[model samples]
Target chain A: MIKSNSTNSNIQQIKVAVDCIIFGFNDNKLELLLIKKKENPEKGKWSLIGGFVGFDEDLDEAANRILSDLSGLQDIYMEQIKTFGKVDRCSFDRIISSTYSAMILKSRYTEDKISKYNAQWFPITEVPDLIFDHNDMVDIAIKRMRRRVRNFPIAFNLLPPKFTLPQLQVLYEGILDEELDKRNFRRKVAQMKYLVRLDEKDMSESRRGAFLYRFDETLFENEQNFNL
Target chain B: MIKSNSTNSNIQQIKVAVDCIIFGFNDNKLELLLIKKKENPEKGKWSLIGGFVGFDEDLDEAANRILSDLSGLQDIYMEQIKTFGKVDRCSFDRIISSTYSAMILKSRYTEDKISKYNAQWFPITEVPDLIFDHNDMVDIAIKRMRRRVRNFPIAFNLLPPKFTLPQLQVLYEGILDEELDKRNFRRKVAQMKYLVRLDEKDMSESRRGAFLYRFDETLFENEQNFNL
Candidate 1:
C-alpha cells in the first residue's frame, strides 16, 4: 500500500545528514578544513562542515552550499564518496550521512572569511579529535582522493594558477602519502605533455628559483581521453 | 540552530525507492528483466522491479530485496549504479530513486517464476518503452555494467561454476555492445593467464564444443594489483 507508515510505526526509521570533507593543498602540506561545532551534543569538538540535508534540496546542492558557506570556494572537484547508513551511528538521532569531498587550493582560501563559528585548517596528518562519525568520513575521503589521484590528474584542481614542479610533486606526495621520485615523477608527467612551462618562476621556495607551470585544462582534458 | 527551519523538514517527506536494472546473458542475447508495475502513479506499465527502501536498511539489502523479489535469486552480482535526484522526476510527490543493477546468467530463473510477475526478458538492443525515467536508468546501468565487466571479473559471477570460451566471449560482447575479434580477444585473455582452461566442454553449441574456462579470483586480484 502507498499509505504512510509514518515515523512512529514499528518499522525502521532513518535520518539523513550531509557531511563534507574538504581537502586543501597549501604550504607544501595537505590540509583539511574542519569546523568546531558549537552546538549541542558535541559542542566545541572538531567536525566536518555538515548539516542535515533539506527535504527539498538535492544532495549535490547541499554539498555546494556547505562548501561555500564555510570556505567561500566553488566550482571545485566534488564527488559522492559513499553513504553511511549504520543504524546506531548517531547517538542523538538515526542520521545516515552522505559524504562529499571538495578540493580547494590553500592559496585560494588564504584570505578566507571566517564566520563567528570557529573554522580552521588542520594538516590531514595532524588532525585534532573530531566529533562523532566525522573521522570516518575524512578517512574515506582520503582513500577516495588517493585512488582518483592515481587514475586522473585531479590534484591540479587543488593548486594555484602558477606553481613550480616541486610544489606539484609535493601536493601529489601529500595526497598519495608517499615519496615520489622527482626524476621519475616529472618524466611521467612530461609524458602526458599537457602542462605549459610558464615564463615566470616562483622564487619563494629556495635559492634557485623554480620555473612555474600552468596546466591547459582543454589540452589536459583531451590528453585524458588518450587512455595513457 | 540544530532545529531545521521547517517542522516537517527532517522527515523523509517523499518516498525513497530503489529500482533494479537486471541484466542477464543468455545464449548470445543481452536481456533485461522488466516487470509490470502493480501500483501507480505508473501502474500496469512495464518498468524495473522496484520498491521502497525500508528505514535503517542498507542499500545492498534493498538491492537484494529487489533481486529476490523478481528472480528468486540471492547473492547475485549486484552493485549500486547511481542515485537519480532530479526534482519532480517522479510524477508523485517528489520521489528520489537510487538505482542498482544485477548481472545474472539467464539460466538461473525458471520460466515459471519469470512468468509469475508477468516478467519478460527483452534483448537490450530491443528494449520496449518503459514507464517513468526507467529507460534512462537502464542506459546508465548498462554503461556501469560494461565498465565493471572489463576491469573486474564481475561477469564471472553471472555465469556458472564452469563456462565455455564462447560463453565468456558472448558475455563480453553483450555487455560491451560491440563486436570483438575472437582470436585477438583470446590472445589477450591468455596473455593475462588468469583463466584456467578445463578439459571438459559444453558440447552444446556445436558438434565439437569449445573448452570451458573459469577465472581464478585470487589470480585476477594479484594481476589487478600489478596492472594498477
Candidate 2:
C-alpha cells in the first residue's frame, strides 16, 4: 500500500495552508476579523489569519486550530468555503490555501487574545485592503455567507441568545447588503415556527420596547428551510 | 517580499491531486464514470479518474486535464465540489485531493476513448465499492449536485441541446431519484420563460410527438433563480 508510481514520484509537493475568514455581527453591521501580518513578504499588512497545515492534520482540523489560536475560543461554527491554489497566490511560496468562513459570537472573544494577534474587527463595508488574495477570499466568503443565510438558520450564530425581531432583520440586511420591506420581512419571520417569544424585551432601540425571541434549535431540527 | 517564515520552511509538503466525479444521463438513469486502476497498491480496482496535479497547473486545470485525458473531450461542465484531505485517505502516500463534480452529455463521448481507459458507466445507485475514499467522494459529489440543481439550471449540461419535455423530466427524475406528477412538473416548466419551444417534434417516444425545446441562455442570464 505504500508503493509509489512514477507519476506520483515525479509530481512536486506543495505546501498547504488554511485561512479563516471570521465573521461577526455587531451594531447592525457585519464585521470581519483580520490580523496584521508580523512577518516579512506582507509584514504589517492586513490578512486573513492563516497558517500552514500540520503534517498530520486534516483540512478542517487545520482551519479550526488556526481560528482557535487567534480567537481564544473553540467549537466555533465554521465551514470550508473554497480552496485557492494559483501558483503565485502566495508570493513567498507556492502554498495552496483552503479557506474557511467562520461565524463566531463577537462578545465571547477576550480582548487580550485579539490584541496578542494584532487582530482588529472591521465593519464588512469598510474593510481595508488585504494582502495577497485575502481580499478576494473575503469577497467570496461574504457571497457564500449571504447565500447560506437564506437557506439555513445560521444567523443565530452571530446573534445573542435573546434578540428582537428588528435586530434579526438588521442582521439579515447586513448580510444581504440590501434593505428589505418591513411588512414583507415580518411576514416571512411569522412563518418560522422555530422562533420562541421570550418574556423579556429590549428597550434601547425605542420607548416601546420590542419583545425578545430565542431561536429554538429543537424546533428547527424538524424544519426544512430558513427562507427568510 | 519573497521572504519565508520559519513555519513555512519547517512545514511538510504533500502531493495534490484532482479527482473528477463525472456524471451523465442515459436511458433515464443517472450514471457515473469510473475507471479500473491499471497499477498499484490496488490494481484492477475501480476508482475515480484522477492524476497528480502538475506543479504549474491550477486545481481546476488539473481537473479538466484528468477528465479530458480519459474522455477525450474538453469544455465539459465541471465544478469543484469539495477538497478531501483526511491525511490517510490515500494509503499510497500523504496526498490531498480537490474533487470536482462534472456533468457531461453521455452521447458525446466516443466509445473508443472509454475502452482505452477501461472506463465503464454504472447507474449511480449501483456504483461498486471504489478504491480508497472515492466512494465517500462520490457521495459528497451527488449531494452537492442535488443541491446545485435546485437553484441552478445545471441539468441542461447533462441533456442534449435539443430535447423534449418528457426527456427533460426524465433527466430531472433520474437526478433527483424521485417520481414527479406530470401535470405539476409541466406547470413549473411553463414558468421558465427560457425554455424556447421549436417547430421540430421528437417522434421517438410516440406517434403524436412531443415538441422540442431549447434552453435559451440569453434569457436565463437575465432571470434570477432556477426554482425548479
Candidate 3:
C-alpha cells in the first residue's frame, strides 16, 4: 500500500447536501419543479428543492424527506444520477450536492401543498436561468431520464393512472425532444405486453376519442424491458 | 422556500472519500486492481485503492489522483457510478465514499510501479472479501460496465492496440458474462464500420492465425454508438 501522508484530522470536512430535480408530465409537455430561494447568496432565484444531509439520515432518506416535505407524496420514483463537487460550485460554502432525478404525476401532488412551499412546475422548454450550478443539474437529469425511459417503464411515473395513446406518444416526444412517426410509434407500443388497453376512452382531446391504457405494474415486473 | 432550521455551523460535517474500482482484461478474463491495507482499521485486508478528497480539488480530480498514484498511468477511462453514504458503512469514521468505475489497459503499466504500491490484479471471480462496502461497489461497477460496453466502444480501453476477432469476442463474453454465438457475433462485428482490420495476424492462439484489428477512434467519434 502507498504510505498515506495525510490523516483524517488534517483533511477538511465539507458539508454534504442533496438536490432533487423533480420532473412531471402535463399538458403533453415535460416540466420541472423549482422553488425560489428565500435567503441570501442568490436569493429569489429559481433552484431545485434541496436541503443539507442530516446527521442521522442516509443520503436517500434525506432526499425522500425533502421530496415528501414539499409535495406531500411518498415512495416517488427517484434515483441519484450524479454528484456535483466543484470547488466554487456553491457561492456561500464548499458543499458537495448529490443530484437526484425524480418523476411524479402532477395530479398526484396537491395544489395547496405546492403553493405552501412556493414551488411551481415550469415546462421544461421554458425553464429560466437557475441559481448556481442548477441549470447544469437539470440538463444532466433530463439526459438521464431520456436514456432511462427508453429501456425501462419508469415513464409511467410521470403520467396519470389511465392515459390516451396520444398522451403517451406526446410524453415520449417531450422526453426525447423529437417528433416520432405516428405509425411506427404505435407499432412499437402495440408490442409491449405490459401496457394494457382498457374499455374506457378519453374524450378530452377529440370527439372520436382515443382508447385509454394503463401500465400494468404486475405484468411489467414480470416481463421487464420497456424497450421504447 | 422551506425555512432552514439546520445551519452550516450546527450540521455535522463528514469525511468525503473516493474509492476506485479499476478493471483490466488479461487472459480473456476481467480483473480488478486491489491493494492490501497496511495500517490500522481493517489492516492486512484487500481493499480498493482510495484516498480522501483534497480541499482544493474536484471529485473527478481526486479520483484521477488516486488512480494515477497507484498505476502511474494518466487519462484512463473513468466515471463516477454511485455514492455510498450509509451511516455505518465505515467502521471507524462517518465517511461518505463516492465510488468511481475505471478501466485501464494492463499492458500500459509497468510491474515495478504496481509492486511499489503492493497492488495486484485479481480475477473478477477470485476477489477476496473486501473491507466495508467495497464488495458491493465492485458488483455495481460490473453491472454499469456491462450496460455501457454494449452501447459504447469503451471496451477497447481494456484490449491491446492490435487484437484478433477471437480476442475481442472473448473480451465481450467476459464483460457480458455469457457466450455469444460465433456467427451472430461476427455478423454484428461486420456491421460496425469503426473496427478497422489490419494486415497483421496474431499466431499465438492457433495454427491458422487470425487477422488483427484496431478501433478507429475518429470514425467511432463520428458514428457515436457502438451498438454491440
Candidate 4:
C-alpha cells in the first residue's frame, strides 16, 4: 500500500504496526509464543507479540526489536508472511500490520524471562483465542512453515544444536501435522548431505541412544538441494 | 508492525504506499506495464503504477483502486509480493510501500487506454531502471513468479480462454526462461486432466493449426495435481 502525500488534505493517517507469530518446537509438538495483553482494549487476553513501527525505523527492524524485547533472543530466522490491512482489525483504531513468522529455539526463552513479560509457549494445536486477527496470523504462519520445511532446512532453527534423528523427525511431523513413515523420513534426511552426524548421542529418548546430528552450515550454503 | 499508542509522544508516523508490478505475456515473451511518473521526485521516468492508501481504506481496496484507475480493468489476479521498508528506498520521504505483482491478459489492455495514461508494456528482461525500489520489486516478483508457475496453474491467467499446447509451452518457457523438451513438456501437460482439449484450433502459429485447450475450472478446482 502507498503512503498518502503530505499535500493531500483529506487523506487519513492510519496507524502502522507489526505482529510476529513466533514458532517453537519442543516435546514433539510445535509451540507458539503468546502474551496476555497488559494494556486496555484487549488487555489480559492472549495476543501475538507486537509493537508499532517507529517513524524512522524499517519494518524489519521494528519486527526484530519487538521480537528481541519479548523473547530475549536475537538473530532468529524470520520471514515476512503478509500484510493484514482489514479496516476493523484493531478495534481501538485503524492499524495496518505487516505480520511475520519467526522460528526460534524454544530453549532460548528462559522461564523467568517469559514470566516477567507474562509470555508463555502454548502448543500450536491448543493456542487460546488470540486478540483480534492474531489467530489468523498464526494459522497462516503454520501453513507457510509446513510448506517451507519440506523445501528448505528452515525448521532446523527450532531444533537444538545437537539432536537425534528421531527428534528431528518429530519436529517435521509436528509441523506437518501428519505421520510420516520412519524409513521414508530417514531416507530423505540421508539424501540431504548438509546434515552431519556427531559423535555424541541423545540418550534421553532411548537407552541405546540415537546418534546426534547437526546441520553443516558450510555445505548447506553451497549445496543445490532445493528439491529436497 | 504494531500501532503506536497515543501516549508515545516521541514516536513519528511514517508514510505508507502501495506499488504494483503488472505482468502480461504475449509474443512469446513476458511483459510488464510501466508508466511515466507524472509528478516529482522523479517525473517523466518509468515507474510502476502506484498510489497512496487513504487513511481508512484497506490495503487491498487501495491496490484495486490504483489498478483499475490505470488499466480501466478490474478483477485482476494480484498478490502481495513483499513490503519494501528500507529508510532510503524512497528519496522524498520514509515511504514504506507494500509491493504487489499482478497477472493480466495482454488483450485486456488496449493501446488507446494505455496511451491515455502514458503506460506501456516492456519485455520483462528489457525493463528499464524504474523509480525508487521498483527494479528490486520486479526482480523479486519474477523469481517468485517462476516458482509459482511450477506449482500452480496461475500462469494460465496470462493466456486467452483458448490456447494451443505450443502457446502454453511458450508462455511457460517465457516465465521459466528455459527451453523445455517438447515431448516432456507435452507429456506433463497431457497428464493434467484439468486441461480440456477443444475441437477448435489456433492457426496463428502454424498453417496446419494446433488444437486449442482450455482450463476446466471445475476439474481444476477438484484435482489434486500440484506438481504440474
Candidate 5:
C-alpha cells in the first residue's frame, strides 16, 4: 500500500486557496462575479475571483485581498461560509478550499471594464456555466446569504446609500426568492427600528415619489446583540 | 507546481474522521471524556473518542458513532465547532479532521465500561496534554459551549431526566464559569417556559427533597423558530 505518511523528509506542504462568491444588485437584478483564470490546468474558463492564501495571513485577510485585486473595493462585508475538502476537489493536488461570501453594490463595473480578460459580472439569472465546482460554490454562498439576511440586515450592504422602501423590498424579494407583502415588509422593518427617514424623496423611479431612508449604522451595532 | 490530483486513480477515497470533545458537569466542575489511543500516530496517549465518517454519512453521524463507541449512547446533542486542516495536522497524509462539541450527561457514562481502557474524566481545570491539535480543538469547543449555554438552552441536554432547580442552576454556573444569583436564574428559566414539573423528588442528598422537572421536547421544537 502507498503509505499516507507525514514522516517523509521530502514531501512538500500543500497549498491552500480562498474563493470569494460575491453577489451584487443593479437595475433590480441580482448579479454574480466571475473571473477568467490566467494560469493553467483550468485556464480560459470562467471561475471565482480567488487566489492562494499567503503565509501568516488570516482567512479574512486573504479573502479581502482577492476582492481588492479584482474589484478595487475595500472594507466591504464578508463572512466565512464553510470549508470544502472533498478528495479530488482540486485537479492540481489536494488543495483544500475555504470559501467566503460577500455582497457588493453593482455599479462598480461597466462595459468598458468588461473587455478586460480578468473578471466580469453576470446576472444571477443568466450566469454562464462556471469552471470546476464554482457553480456549487455560488449555490452554497446563496444559501448562506439567504439564511443570514433572514436573521440579520446584511442586505443593506448591497443597496444604494439612499434607497426607497420599494427598492429595499425588491432586494429582499430577489434574495429570498419569494414575494413578500409590501405592508408586512414595512411593518417588520419598522419593528426592527434600524432604518431612519432621510427627509429626501427618490422621484426618478415612479410617478409618486418615494421617501429615501438611511440605515442607522450605530443603532444597528447597538441593537445587533438582539439579532443573530 | 505540484500536480493537484488525487493520490491514486480508481481507488477508494480516503476516510474522514470526526472526533468529539464531550464535556459534562459534576460536583460543580466541568469534565471532559478522554480515551487512550489504541493505535499509533500517538498511541497510548489520552485523546477524545473518534471514528471515521462513512461514504453515506454526514459529519454529525460520524460524531454520534464516536459517542456510542465510547459512552454507549446515541441521540446526544452535538455541535460542529470547527474543521482542522493544517497540512501536517495528522502524522498520516491528509486526514482532514473536523472537531465536534457535545455536552453529554454525566449519568450516561458506564463506570465499568468507561474505566476499561485508559479512558477517564478530567476536570477542565486539570486536563492532561492531548495528541496533535486535540488540545486546540478542546479549547474552541469549551469556548463555544460556554457561549451557547449563556444564550441557548443546550445545558438541558447534559442534565438528568428529572433534575432539581438548583441542579439546573449549578449546570449553568459550571458552564458559564460565573456565580449566578439563584433567584435570577429561576426567573430566566421560568420565563423561557419549556420545563414541566414531575411528581418525583430526589431524597438521597438532602432531608428536604427537591422537586424534579424535565424539558418538554415538543414545546422546545415548536418554539425553535423563535429563540428561547
Candidate 6:
C-alpha cells in the first residue's frame, strides 16, 4: 500500500495511459478503428491505439494526439469516457489508463493514414478479441456513446456535414440499435427545430431523392438545453 | 515530455490522490462535507477529504475508504466523477487526482463523527476556498450529479426510507437548482409509477400533512428505461 504522506520515499508512482475508442458509421452499421499491437507484451494482437500520458501533457491532449496519430483527423469530437485502474489491467506494469471515446465521420479518414498504422475498420458488433482490457474499454465506450446520443446533439459528429433525412435516421438507428418508425422519427426531427432544411437533394438512393438537411450551429449554440 | 518507451529509466512516476466530494441535503439546501487538512503542506486549510491511492487498492476502494474515514458512512452512493490530471494541480509533486462524488442524507451522519475530524457542512452555493483544484472538482461534481439525478432513480438515496412527494420534489429542486411546476411534477411522478404510496403522513411541514411514499425497487429494477 502506498502511503498518503507526501514525504514518504517508499511510495511508488504508477504509469498512466490514455486509450482512444474511435467510432465511425457507414452502411447502416457502427464501426470501430482498431490497430494491431506492434510492441512487446502484446505484439500482433488487436488493440486500442493507446500510449502513456506524457508528464508534460494533459489527459485531453494525450487523447487528441493519439486520435490524430491514428486517424489523421484533427479537432475530432472526443469525450473522456472514464479511467480504467484495475490493479492488473496492463500486463507489463502497474499502469492506469484514462479511456476516451470519439465520434468521427468514416469518410474523414484517408486510405494512406489508415494503412500507415495498419488500422482497420471493423463492425462494432463483430470486433475481434482485443489485447488486455481493450475489449472492456470498447464496451464501456459504446454504452456511454449510446447514452450520449440519446440526450445531446453531439452524434452529428458521426455523419457528414450534409445528409438526407433517411441517412440521418439510419445513423440514429445504427447507434440506438433499434428500428424507428419513419413517420415518428421525422416528426421528432421536425420538433427539434435545430436542423435546417437545405435546398440540396441527395439522389443516391432513389429517383425522387431525399431533401438534405444540416445542423444549425447558431441555434444549437444559443439553445443550450436543446435535446432530442 | 515523458517517453512512452517502458524501458526509459528517466521516466518519472507521478503521485496520484483521490478526493471525495460528499454531498448531503437538508433544509432545502445542498451541503458539502469539507475538512481542515491535517497534514503538512497546506495543513489546516479547507480541502476535500482525500488520500493517496494505495498501490494494491483499486481506485473505487480508495474512494470508499476515504469517504468512510471522513464521514463514517460506508457503501454510500459514490461515483467517479472524473480524473483531474493538470500538471500543476498539486503543490507538493506531480500529482494527478481522481475526484469522486457521493450523496448521503444529512441526517445519516452523527454530529460526533463530523467533529472528530473538524469537518463542517457548508451549503454548496457558498463553499469556502479549498486547496489545490478542489473548487473545480466541486463544480464538475455538481454538473455530473444534476445530469445523473435526471436520468437515474439514484436520487432516492438522498432521502430517508419514507419521504413525502414534496420532499422528493425538494430533492430534485436542490439538485437541478430550479423550480418545477407542482402540477407538472406530480403528473410526471404519476407516470413513473415506481413510487409506492405508504399509509403514513408527515405532519412536520403542515397540519394537513403530506402523504409519505417509498420507492419500489422491484418495479424500478423491472423497468429497464425510466427517464424524466
- Which candidate comes out best when scored by TM-score? 6
Error of 3 at A178 (Å): 1.5
DockQ of 6: 0.32
Error of 1 at A119 (Å): 2.9
| Residue clash pairs of candidate 3 | none
For all predictions in the order shown, the interface RMSD in Å is 5.7, 5.8, 7.3, 5.4, 9.0, 5.7
TM-score of chain B of each: 0.82, 0.83, 0.81, 0.82, 0.73, 0.83
Ordered from best to worst DockQ, the candidate numbers read 2, 6, 4, 3, 1, 5
Off by over 4 Å in 6: A1-11, A160-164, A183-228, B1-10, B160-164, B187-228
Question: Comparing candidate 4 with candidate 6, which one achieves the higher DockQ?
Answer: 6
lDDT of 6 by residue, A65-134 (tens): 8877865667876778888888777655677888888777776667677877768889998999998799
lDDT of 4 by residue, B36-125 (tens): 887777988999888888766789888888877876657776798898888778876777888888776677666687777768889888
**TM-scores of the candidates in the order shown:** 0.76, 0.83, 0.82, 0.81, 0.60, 0.85
lDDT of 1 at A216: 86
DockQ of each: 0.20, 0.33, 0.28, 0.28, 0.14, 0.32
| Cα error, candidate 6, residue B96 (Å) | 0.9
Candidate 6 TM-score over all chains jointly: 0.85
lDDT of 4 by residue, A1-228 (tens): 334354642334677788988887666677898888888978889999898887778899889999888766567757898988877787767778898887766666566777777688898879999988998888888877776677568877677788888888878777787887888788778867899999888788778989999998878767532310
* Cα lDDT of model 1 by residue, B6-87, tens digit: 4554345545677888888787678998887776667788888777677656656877877688756667766666666565
Residue pairs that clash (backbone atoms under 3 angstroms), model 2:
none
In model 1, pairs of residues that clash are none
Better of 1 and 5 by DockQ: 1
Residue B60, candidate 6: how far off, in angstroms? 1.1
- Cα lDDT of model 5 by residue, A144-195, tens digit: 6776676567888677788888988898888776788877778777756788
Regions of model 2 farther than 4 Å from truth? A1-12, A159-165, A186-228, B1-12, B159-167, B182-228
**Candidate 5 residue runs with Cα over 4 Å from true position:** A1-7, A11-15, A38-40, A54-59, A65-77, A108-115, A160-164, A193-228, B1-100, B111-228
Expressed as tens digits, the lDDT of each residue in A1-228 for candidate 3 is 221223433334567889999987666677899988888877889989888887667888888898777656568867998999897787656778898887766776677778877688899998999987999999999977777776567787667799988888888887777887888778768866899999999988899999999999888766532110
Fnat of the models, one by one?
0.14, 0.41, 0.35, 0.32, 0.09, 0.32
lDDT of 6 by residue, B62-161 (tens): 8888878876767775778899888777765667888888877788668787777668899988899999999999999997887667656778877789
RMSD of 6: 4.7
